[model samples]
Target: MSRFTTQLAAGLLLAPALLAASAVQAHETGDIIVRAGVVAVDPQENSGNVYVGGANTGLEVGVDSNTQLGITGTFMLTDHLGVGVLGATPFKHDIQLKGVGRFASIKHLPPTVTLQYYPMDKSSVLQPFVGAGLNYTTFFSEDLSSAAEGLGFSDLSLDDSWGYALEAGLDYKLTEQVYLNATVWYADIETTATFRTASVPSKVDVEINPMIYMASVGYKF
Candidate 1:
């Protein structure tokens, strides 16, 4: 497994310990919770072979990790059910061409909406929830590195992606209105990268299924 994957697994494994250290509390209906903190985007990416002039290049690509400011708000419809919106600053990732060094860079925004279900009752201090939702990602501000341009690459563009997202999170209440939150989400994202090499525009299919992690402080009102 990759280092990021291992770290994510470790974080999830420590959830029970987190619960053990905090009081159990449940959210009530008509409550609004707002959270803000840092979020990391780690893409477990895969790509098809690149082509140039209708010839296979036998090269694969990968994406590097990025962290950005994350903000979210949740409104409780019932004690156990809530609707939430997740947002973040644009995430920037370096597109690495394996063995051939850095290739390009891209920035994207992933906005998500989900329905969350909390399993505990109102008196509990630690809230653990599961959510399923939709993720819409838009790619922009693509740039080709100097090296890539030197290699005859230009006119790069990445297609927008719309996919499903799954989330698991835990909230530990520190006071009546304050809490610490830890959450992880996985999004199924796919895109087609089109660029010109030697004046020939070529396309590559890429799957950038990313796992997002967030740790934040929240307020309930």
Candidate 2:
């Protein structure tokens, strides 16, 4: 056979393989779907700040109880496997050290993407999922004693932190567009903040309870 004919025949033999692979990928994609859910967060960080105040300054501040509206997108990779993206607004709050004329809050946005596996069908009324992932916490917009009158402005000590994530959740499908979900996840979000006006910088070895009671209504095609 001529060289051109030989190449043409080889391509013909390979065409079926390529077509099969494409079909497999397409099936995987169709089996896979994206699910978005609402995430509400409440976090408590420990710290103390100091400002020059004589006698006493109610430098009293409270724990940062922040409830945020966040979203999570999920994709099913297989009948028993899935992957997802969990994103949320940056969390912010202030701390008031009693008797000290100083207060501050650490702020950050935590965006996490995880690979999950489920043992139930999408059409199943109840589906549960477990996953592992990486968590990136970016701290920003840190401010001090904004509510504390006469409290001079000082710098905040927060740095970007990275950690591992372990998650487990259950999805109860009420309907295709409405489902109830509950998830509990743990992350090692240990970060250090150096208060410029305090005795020293504080290192926070805090575990963000990404663990939340989740309930959401999702859509499927």
Candidate 3:
């Protein structure tokens, strides 16, 4: 398994042990929770063949995963319900082509909003939640590799996407006002990449359904 997966598994295994200690009041109405930590975006992509001037090139597109700083905020509406927003620093991904190395790079931000449901009671130290949300992703800073440029590619761009997202997470209270948290999200993200090659317009449809993971420390007020 990958290092991140191993670490996440370890955290899940340790959560029960940590929850055995003394407990504190979990989220209450009017409470606000803020968290920050590392987040990774792993794309499970299905890419269409590159079309150069309406001709299929048979080259498949791929995107590499990236890790970035993640921040989240939640406001409790009741003891068991909250609204949350997730943010992160721009994630940079390498765009690769089949039979070719990295051909381009792009940066994007995914901001998500969710209605979260906490299933545990207020006195529980281990709080597990599930959420469903919408995600808006904006892509920018698209740059072609030198090799791609040399091959007469230019003006690369990616369209922004709006998609649905699902989340599952756990929070282990360490104190009345602090906690350790781990969350995972799946987002449906699709975009059309457009560029010019040999001065002819080319486009490719890419479905980047990504799983996002975050391990964070949270504070409540």
Give all candidates' CA lDDT scores. 0.92, 0.59, 0.95
Q: Give stretches of model 3 more than 4 Å off.
A: 1-23
What lDDT tens digits, residue by residue, belong to model 3 across residues 80-173? 9999999999999999977887889999999999999998898888999999999999999999999999999999999999999999999999
TM per prediction: 0.87, 0.66, 0.89
Clashing pairs in 3: none
Top lDDT prediction, candidate number: 3
Model 2: weakest 10-residue lDDT segment is 49-58
Better candidate number, 1 or 2, judged by lDDT? 1
TM-score of model number 3: 0.89
Give lDDT tens digits, candidate 1, residues 1-221: 99999999999999888865664445989999999999999999989888877788898888999999999899999999999889999999999877789999999999999999999987688999999999999999999999999988999999999999999999998898899999999999999899999899787789999999999999998
Point out where model 1 deviates above 4 Å: 1-25
Worst-scoring 10-residue span by lDDT in model 1 = 17-26
Ranking by lDDT: 3, 1, 2
